[model samples]
Every structure is written in C-alpha cells, then in structure tokens.
Target: MESPIYLDNNATTPLAAEVVDAMAEAMRAGYANPASQHEAGRRARRVVEAARERIVELLGGQTGGRQPDRLIFTSGGTEANNLAMFGLARMAEDRYDGPHHLIASPVEHPSVARAADALACENWQVDHLEVDAQGVVELASLENLITDRTRLVTTMWGNNETGVLQPVAPLASLAASRGAMLHTDAVQAVGKIDVHFGNSQASSLAFTAHKFHGPLGIGGLLVRGDTQLAPQLFGGFQQAGLRPGTESVVLVAGLRTALELWHTERSARLQHLTSLRDRFEQQICAELPCAQVVAAGAERLPHTSNIAFRGVDRQALFLALDMAEVACSTGSACASGSSEPSGVLLAMGCSDEVVRGSLRFSFGAQTTPPEVAEAARRISKACKHLERQKHR
Candidate 1:
C-alpha cells in the first residue's frame, strides 16, 4: 500500500510516537486518582503538576508571581473555548450591572461564536467584529464596538480556516484599556506560533493537544490569576473547581511530551512547513492560472494555504484528492461535513463563488516535499477534470 499524503494537519495531527509512549507509560503505572490521599494519589498528583509545569513553560508563562495557576483542562478545544466564553460571561454578569455585551470576530471557531450566540439568547448583547478581505480583524472598528457594557472581547489568535493571524496584542491592549477582559482561542496558534501568557495581555486563551501532535480529547483554558471567571461545571474541586472531573493522566502526559518536543524544535518545524506550503502554492498557481490564493499577503500560519479554483466545486476537489490518496480539507474540519460555504471565507469578503471553490491544505511535521508536490499535481489534475465536466 502506498503512503497517503496528509495535508490536513490543521484539522488534526497524528499522535507522535513520544506522546504515545508517554501516555502508555502513564496508563500502566500512574492510574491512581489524583484526588485521593494515598501515596499512589500523591504520585498521580505529582505527574499532573509536572505536566502543568511543562505546558506552562511551553506557553512561556511565568512560573511564579501572579502567573496563571488556573489551567482548566477540558475535553478538547471546543469545550475549552466554551468554558472560556460562558464562564467569563457569567462572571461578568454577577460582578457588573446593566446589559452585558461581548465582542468577537466573525471568523472565530464556531465553539466561541456559537457560545456567544447562546449567551446572546439569554439577553446578553453579542457584537461580532468583522474581518477585512485579508482575514485580519478590523482593529479600527474594535474601538467603537467596545463600550462600558462590553464585558469580554473574544477573538481567535489564528483563524483555523484561512490560517490568518490576528493582531491579538493590539486587540488585547484595546480590551484592557476599555476595562473588558480579552479571551483568545489559540487552538491553531499554540504549536504553530509562540504564545506567551505572561507577556500577553489576553486574560485567557484556549488550546487543544491534537493541534500540536498530541493525543486528542485533551485541551486547556489558560486563565490569568487575577481573572474572575466563574466555573461552568459544578462538581469536585478538580482543576481548582474551574473544570471538574477525573484527570486523564495519560492524555496530560502525552500533551506535555508533545509540547516539549514542539518547544524544542518549533523554529525548524515552522520553516519546513512554510517552505512546503509556499512550494505547494507556487506549483498550484503555475499549473492553474485561474486559482486564487486566499489571503495571500496576510500574515498566515506557516502550514496553511487556502486556494480558490474558479468554476470548480470544492467538494468535488476534496473527494478527488482523497481518492487520489492525498488528504486535504474543504475548509475548517469542524464544518467539513456541511455543504454550505465557509463562514470564515464569507466573512473575509470572499464572493460566494470563491467560498464554494475554496480548499484548505495544511502541512505538519510528517509532511514531506514529495507529498506536497504530489498533492499539488493531483489538485491540478482534479481541477482540469472538474472544469471539463462543467463544460460538458
């Protein structure tokens, strides 16, 4: 059997061998419940603390001072995002008076945007910030949207679909000046870019392990020590009562190992992926003159490229690539099953035709030059076939 090329790392990555080994070892011997008082429990607690330390270090957070000890591990990126949005929104309600509002970019993952919508249903005002054609947040419009009633301003550090990196630092600073807490969903940004909780003004950030070559079903919300976010779950005092449940020592250990590896080799890995992405795009453009690279000049992540082919159905191209043994995506994996155009593209001022014709290809550590070249070849061929079929 031939090795299938994977260009969908933004959707999820294969678990690293180191991560699997660490997880297996943890499951074999670190089975004690961390909440118990026995020696085994102490051992489990130590492992959890050590994993937390590694994660904090990877995120470049200070170990001491008013640093964040409020790391709440959740099911995944979606849950972490929900916890950050709902938890902070509730806290704002309890602490402040009058109508509470939230400001978020329209290009945000549905986890954050949908949670804000749910909050809005409960009478909270939710204002969605629009992104420009380049997929960056319109910073000028942000100042006008932030008013006294705005409790939180939630935006993604990197868009999952277009891989467009937002001006999070400036947005965070703006939120802080307006007396509003800022939360950024950094799920796509954590391993691909440098994230510093100690230095960043964002009150909270969310990340998932799978995005970083770690095991799935594990992620966390990084809440600043001074942030007054309320717990969304009600139960035991696990994760300082912010996220309650029996901790998955195996998953946590795997995540820490993955994070450690990423921290050590981030620069080299980024350069490699960037080269692969650029090469892929160049080949695509050379082969298909009608293709348009979405947000071509924007500051996108090193691994991602979203391209639009004129008069070609993205779904057809997606399945064609899959059948050709090259795995890619139509847009965000979360919305892959849907036939509708990508909200991210639509929000970035892309025409309906562009939205319907877009495909997202993301690279990762396991991706190779040959794989990218082959994938681009397959895509060009598929586009030709699609065009011929349309003409028929």
Candidate 2:
C-alpha cells in the first residue's frame, strides 16, 4: 500500500531526524535532575542552560534590554499560555486598586479564551475583541476598548485554524501606550513564521516544540525583561518558581535542535511551502469551483489553507477523504470531537453552510509537490463523489 499524504501539519508535525538523535543522546548522557548540586546534576544543569540560550538565540537574541529575557519551560504551549495569561492577570490583581480588565481576540485558541473566561469568573472585565470577515481584529475598536484599568492584552500571533496572521505588533504598541502589558501566544507562528522577541513589544510570548517538528510535552514562555509574572506552579526553585518542575533534558535538547534547523533554513522553507500552498489551492479551486478559501485576502501562513466547500457536510466529506487515504481537519486539533461549527468562522460572519463545510490543509517542511498533487486529486475525487450522493 502507498503511504498516505499527511497535510494536517497545523495540528502537529512529525519530529525531525536530528531532533530525535539529539533527544536520545541527552536521555543517555544528561539524565540527572538539573537542580541537584552534585557533579552529575551540574552537568545536567549545564545542558539545560545551554538549551535555554539556544532558544533565546532562536527568538532573535535578547535585544529588548540590557538584561537577558526569561524562558520558562512548561508541559507545552497550553501551560505556557496559561502561565502568561493567568499568571499576569493574577499579578495585576495584586497590584491594581479596583476591578482589573483583560482583552483577547475573538478567534484565540481555547487555551487563551478559556483563561480569559476563568479571569471573568473572578469579577474581572474580559472583552472578546471583534474581528472582521477575514478574521483580523479591528484595531480602532481595540484602541477604544482600552482603559486605565486594562492590565494585560492577550492575543495569538497566528490563528491556528485559518492561518491568518494577527496584528500582534501594532496591538503590542497600542497596549504599551496604554500602560497595559501584552502577551502573544506564538505557538503556531514561531518556527513557521518570522517571530522575534527582540522586535516585538509584547511583555511575554509562548510557543511549543511539537508545532515545529520537535518533541511534544516541551514548550516555553519568554518573559521580557522585568515583566512581572506571578508564579503559576509552586514547588521548588526551578524557573524562578514561575514554572516549577524537574526539567526534561531530552525534550529540551530536541527543542534546541529543531529550532536551530528552523532558524537556519527559514527562508528556503517559507518559499517552498508557499509554492506548494499556492499550487494546492489552484488545483482544489479548479476542481471545485464553488469552494471558497477562508481568509484568502488576508496574509496567512505559507503552509496552511482553509477551504470551504459549499453544499457539503464536512463530517461526511472528511470521512470520505479519510477512506480515500487523504488527511485533513475541520478546525483546531484541540477542538476536535465537537459536532459544532468553528467559532472562528462564525465570528467572521460566515453562514452555517460555509462554517460546517470548511476544512484545514496544512503543509510541512518535508511536504513535496507530488504529495500535494496526489492529495488534491484524492480530495477532488472524494468531494465529487460526496456531492453526487447528496444530489441523489
């Protein structure tokens, strides 16, 4: 049997060969607790510190200030986002006089949205900033929403489902002007796009290794110089007590290797993925003339394309594609198993018909033109078959 074309890279990517090898070596050699004061522990501590410095270098070095920034490793992007969102909000609670406020875009990942909800329950004013038809948030409205009490503004750098790039930089500047801290969830943007901590004014940013061909269960939140982040986890002196835990030396090694590869080959990878995405979109659009590419007018990730096929049930079409050995998704991987349409699309004012019919196809660094062409062929055939059955 032929291998299936894997196009659902937006959900997660397969680990790179170099990343796996580095992880194996770290597991064998640096297998002691980093906090231990003995020789073996000191060696492990050195490995952990080296990994942290490599990550900082990947994020464009510590150019924001004289002091080096802080990167706290967590279970993954979810924990990193929670630490940035919940941790900062709690810090604001301790500093401010009366009811503090938080802001987030409507199309944020569940991690950010749910964290905002938790803050709202504590009597904090949480506003879901509005987005336009292309899923880009309204900047003018965001300015109007800011008040003196607004403590932090949380937004994702790139949308997970639509792949639309948000106005994170301008938002950060706006938040800074209002004396409010900014935090961006850059999980989907870090390795796939040009995300640099030095260039951004955000007080904190989060990312995960698994999103970029590294090991899962390892991610970090970069806290800018002197950012006040209250401890999210409690136990020992790890990560300044911000995210206390015995660091995974092997996972950190994998992350460092993956990031180094991405940093060095970013330009070539972007061009390659962009070409594949354009060709794939052209093929699918030619085969299905009635289909609409979500956020086509907006700047999107080079590897991601969300297509909405009118008059087709996405669940049925997805199953058909799966049977044909094609892989795709209806929305965010974290929101899988839900019968409901995407809130992101609904927020963009898409009708129920369009919302239920959309599917995400994301490419990877290793995806080839032949694989994309074959996947498009299979998808076109499956969609045609589904449409005929519905007409019958």
lDDT of 2 by residue, 116-161 (tens): 8998998999887889999998888689899999999988888999
Residue-pair clashes per candidate: 0, 0
Q: How high is the CA lDDT of each candidate model? A: 0.88, 0.89
Q: Give the TM-score of candidate 2.
A: 0.98
RMSD of each: 1.2, 1.2
Per-residue alpha-carbon lDDT of model 1 for 1-392, expressed as tens digits?
44688889999999988889999998888479988889988889899988887787678665577545467788899999999999998898899996998898999998988898898899988888878889999888898799988899989998898889998889999999989999999999898878887677888889999998999999998888788878888888888788889998898898899899898999899899889989999999999987999999899989889999977888888888888888889977887898987889888888877888899999888888998998888889988988888889
In angstroms, the error of model 2 at 88 is: 0.2
> RMSD of candidate 2 to the true fold?
1.2
> Where does candidate 1 stray beyond 4 Å?
1-3, 66-69
Worst 10 residues of 1 by lDDT: 61-70
